[model samples]
Target: MNRKELEQRLRQELALPYYNAKIAERDYSESEFQEMKAQLQADIEQYARDYVNESNANG
Candidate 1:
């Protein structure tokens, strides 16, 4: 996928209900929130990469 599409996908995937609850309840401090978001983004990016790799390999 292109950069734009990948970014959009990441945003959509990052909107998890568990995280939403944490944000709504003020469960984490600002730095903590940022750290969590950063990690989640990294994880999502890796997952996307893995999915693409698998698809290419299968074909």
Candidate 2:
């Protein structure tokens, strides 16, 4: 995807987990909350890598 597309995708991808994480803080256990947070971080890293690789390829 292009940079703009990537930005939009990243925004959508990251939003739900963040919203859930907010709710999860109250409902999920400590380990569960940590897992959710870790997954979000992983998702972010993967998206960054994909965006970089895609951008490089497009260029």
Candidate 3:
């Protein structure tokens, strides 16, 4: 699927009660665990930067 469709699906799924638990478990892996954690950390940092930029723009 495309980005828009994928995001829409994610938004829909996130509305469910068990979304957080299952979503975290879906990334489960024994060997690639460190890589996943690093990737997720980078993703969070990038998002924070984007949010800061948007806030500065609005302010």
User: In order, how many clashes per candidate?
Assistant: 0, 0, 0
Candidate 2: regions farther than 4 A off: 1-26
Best by TM-score: 1
Question: Which 10 consecutive residues of model 2 have the lowest summed lDDT?
Answer: 17-26
* lDDT (0 to 1) per candidate: 0.58, 0.55, 0.50
**Each candidate: RMSD:** 10.0, 11.5, 9.5
**lDDT by residue for model 1 (1-59), tens:** 43333344445657753332223332344555457568878887999999999999999
Instruction: Give me the displacement of residue 11 in model 3, in angstroms.
Output: 21
lDDT of 3: 0.50
Candidate 2, TM-score vs. the true structure? 0.57
Score every model by TM-score. 0.57, 0.57, 0.51
Residue-level lDDT of model 3, residues 1-59, one tens digit each, is 43334334444643432223123323334344445345555766899999999999999
User: Which residue runs of candidate 1 sit more than 4 Å off their true CA positions?
Assistant: 1-26
Tens digits of per-residue lDDT, candidate 2, 22-51, equal 231133445554565577779879999999
Q: How far is candidate 2 from the true structure (C-alpha RMSD, Å)?
A: 11.5
Error of 3 at 15 (Å): 22
